[model samples]
Target: MPLTPQRAHLQFGVVLLAGALLPALPLAGQQVLSVFAAASLTEAFNDLGRAFERAHPGVTVRLNYSGSQVLATQLEQGARADVLATADQRWMQYARDRRLLAGDAATFARNRLVVVIPRANPGYVEKLQDLTRPGLKLVLAGAQVPAGGYSRESLRRLNGAPGFPAAFDRQVLANLVSEEENVRAVVAKVRLREADAGIAYATDVGARDRDALTILEIPDPYNPIAEYPIAVVAGGHRELAGAFIALVLGPEGQALLATRGFLPPAPRR
Candidate 1:
């Protein structure tokens, strides 16, 4: 019998639906390792992920990037991942406190905050104090984010610096017109000219970013150095996760991270 148009359409729809579900199909003798890491680790971790896959055949590295707090919240809500890396000790502690970790979290990297301005210099920002200029639009990550917290702390420290005004931090905070969920979002808004300036990790201002951004370095004394922590997740693929973590803390991984502008882990106290 000749197929009718309606019946043919139904068969096509079923084929498309089956194709959509293909990702759910399992592959024999293959392993998947899921990693939940902070947004700031995106560049370095992506390189690390690729390196991990190269060394381990038949294994896939699934990476999830977001604000450190959001990652912690997701883990709290039962997100399935084999490894967790955060931009600060706070969220790593958040996970540890809730027993979401398989072992002690290791400090794997460090980063410092910097002020990023559009190359166009829309607000005439030349230095840290310029952040206090009235009506100057500024974007910052939400208070919950590690970069956001470090940014605020660094700003407050500026108040005590010799050249800055006593109300430096407060005035700067008043100019904030938007709060982003992650450091990258803050950088994106500043680059887009949606805001005059933003605070983000120094690593964010890559060669590509430099094309559109003018980075002003914060003083060493006033800068807040962020510590990054990584660990295996409880109830995850512990052995594979440990291998990944070892790679991150190893010479090959450290070199890869350095190429992407991440700092060596601070010396143990």
Candidate 2:
């Protein structure tokens, strides 16, 4: 039967529609891998996210960064993600106790605390002793933040140091002008000179912040090592999550973390 012009036009339209849909077929199977990580892991994880995308075609990496406790609370409240990376073992234990994790959490990296002061030295915070000086405005992450806990622990150790005052810990705590939600916020407050000083991870003070701040290193004897842990989240894409974790524990990820100022995972005793 000879086709009419109207029938031919309809057939041509169908052909064009099919062609348009063809290019979209590959995207149908593309999946997003969600990662929830602590704020301190921002740079390292962002780089890892890109690397994972490169290693696994058709997969998109979505990273969510916040305080470890905040991330844990979010997960507890029903937020969903494929992986969770925390700054300390405490919160990973929190997830494990609740069965919010699919597997054992491995310590991937370590960090140490430091005190950052404005470059101009407005607070005249010259040494550890100054942290407890009366009227000194100090900012620290809230006690819930892993960095904050490390900071407090270091302060307590310093309090017992020979030269420090007996009430050094209490005095420093009394100097607190702000308690930020995360370590990054503590760095921000110090950079802005909103607080005379802030206690944050040594890694948190990056090259970008060097011009605006000065770091007073905490002695190793007084500084506590902050352990970072990673694991696959419960009900998540286990295979992909495990793969991502392997990448983190792999050479490439560890090298990347080293460049970001994170210490290698501590050797097991």
Per-candidate Cα lDDT values, in order, are 0.94, 0.93
Please, what are the lDDT tens digits per residue for candidate 1 over residues 1-269? 68999999999999999998887776556899999999989989999999999999899899999999999999999999999999999999999999999999999999988999999999999988899999999999999999999999999889958989998999999999988999999999999988999999999988898889999999899998999999999999999999999999999999999998989998778
Off by over 4 Å in 1: 1-5, 24-28
Clashing residue pairs, backbone N/CA/C < 3 A, model 1:
none
Q: Among these predicted structures, which one has the highest TM-score?
A: 1
RMSD to truth, every model: 1.6, 7.5
Query: How many residue pairs clash per model?
Result: 0, 0
Measured with C-alpha atoms, the lDDT of residue 5 in candidate 2 is 98
